[model samples]
Structures are given as C-alpha cells and as structure tokens.
Target: MELDILAEKENVICEMVSNLYRTKSNDDSEIFTSIYNQYKSIHLQYSELSKNNLEALKRGLFIQWYQKTEPNFLSGISDLEQDAEKQIVNNLFTVINTKQVDSELIWMLNYYNSWDWVFLNYENFRRFDTNLVNEANNRLPENIDKKLMLKRGQMGKYWLSLIKYGSTE
Candidate 1:
C-alpha cells in the first residue's frame, strides 16, 4: 500500500473512532476495540509492507486487502475523498450501534503506539512535518485539502493531555 493511502486509512479509522466516541452511546468502548483490532493488523501488515514494497507501499495501495476481506469495511466508516466516503461512515455507525465496550483501552493504547509508524517512519516524511514540499513524497496527495494529519496531531495531543490532566470538558 502507498504511504499516502495508509495515512488516509489511518485518517478514516481515526475518524471512525472519534465518531464512535461522539455517539453518547454506551457502545463506544466495544466499537473502539473492534476497530482498533483491525488497525493493529494493518499496523503489522504495514511493517511487512514497508519491508517488502518500500517503493510501492508508500502509495498505500495495500489497503485493498481490507476492502476485499471485510464487508462494507471502508464503506462502513466515514466518507473518504479518493474512494467512496459514506461507506466508512456507515461502517462505523454499524459497529458502535451493535456492541459494547469491552477492551476499548487496548485499541486506544495501540493507536498511540502506532503514531510513530505513520509520521516518523519514512525518509522524506520529516519534510512534511516541517514544510509541505516534495510533492510525490508528501504524506497526503497535494490535491486533497483535508489537513487530516494536522487534525490527528491535535487529537493525539488532546488524548495525551487527557491522560496527564484528565478531560474535564
């Protein structure tokens, strides 16, 4: 898979987790765990992919694995820009509505652990963190204006703050 695609998937899955958290329902934990588990597998695969297809995987084309295996997988979450967006939103809605949180923290921890994988693992990726140069090497395609990586960074900081001071809001 291309790095951008993986980054995009990470964005989608993170959005799904955030949406699940927003539902005000009791099932956020369960839904979070399920999605987190799927994310873990992808992380493992990402390592393997980074090793084998260093050049091609940067494109994030590897996400096709989930698209092929899971039913309405991406479609069940939120709307994506490159592919169909609403499918992901729907997928996320389905999971949260059906389950209860059992091991939600596990996924949350894994998500935090994987942060370095998405941002710090690449060669020219550091450039993106500084200035948006190297068109082909940018984590996201130049055409998309979503600023997802920025949002994720904000969310990550917020979560860490929650762990340190706690969320009073």
Candidate 2:
C-alpha cells in the first residue's frame, strides 16, 4: 500500500488500538465486536494490504504499527469462546509484548512459530527506517478553514438589456 494514506490514518489506527484497552466490557461478544470493528476499519482502509493474514497480514496495520511503535499494545478482549479469535490475538499480544530485547536469538526455544503470517507475500511496504515514511507523515492533510463567496463567475449579471432571454423581447 502507498505510505501516503497509511500515514494519513496513522493517528486513527493508534486511537483504535488504544480503544481496545479503554474498552471495559467483560462480555465475550462485546469484546469480539470491538475487535471486529477495529479490524474492519483497518482492513477497509487497506484492502490491498495482503493476500491473507489475520493468518498474518490479516493483522497488517496491527503488525506494521506495532513493530514501529509498540507491540502487545493492547489486548482488551476477554471471556471469548474457546474458539475465539481473541485467543489468537491475545497470544499474538503476548508474543509481541515480549519483543523488548534486541536479540532474535532470545526466541530460539519458541514453539508455534507461525502467527500473523499473511498467507501470501506483500510488496511495497513502508518501513520505520525509511525517509519516505517521514515524508508521508509530513504530507498528511491539515484542517483548513473554508469561506463563503458572494458572487458567481459571471459577475452577478447586471446587464441593462438582459430583462428577457431573447433580444427581441
């Protein structure tokens, strides 16, 4: 996806994730609904993110935003059915929360190694290390003030002989 629109929605994504924690619902359905809404918003904004990920990129925005900012950012879901997607996300949250150290070797003994893997490969992604990302951030639209105009392109049409459409009138 082009970094421009993603950058535009960066704040939006952050707030959505933050809402997960802000949500105090203990009902599994409520929790699931919240997650589903957030997921849908992210997916809608980026329908082309990946072929299949919630298998992996299914968490496209989640993964990208988390990697750059913070991981295990929020896991507000709870009491979901055993087959709950929350369980999957919670586990993801756990693993992501543990990425504090700067060592890949720290995960040598880890099992169930394939979480959040998009079923297909993605291309043209923006990374935190790239200056283009900075430019994209800078290019986000800002709030603008609009003004009312008093006249039209024809200068209000005050013609002396223009009382009727036909000159013969």
Strongest candidate by lDDT: 1
Residue-level lDDT for 110 in candidate 2: 24
Each model's number of backbone clashes?
29, 7
lDDT of 2 by residue, 20-93 (tens): 55774555455556654554444444434332222222233333322323333353222223222333334334
| Residues 14-114, model 1: lDDT tens digits | 66856755675775656655675655554444444533343223212223223333343332322113221222222222333443212322233233233
Per-candidate Cα lDDT values, in order, are 0.37, 0.32
* TM-scores for every predicted model: 0.32, 0.25
| Model 1 score (lDDT) | 0.37
Clashes of 1: 29
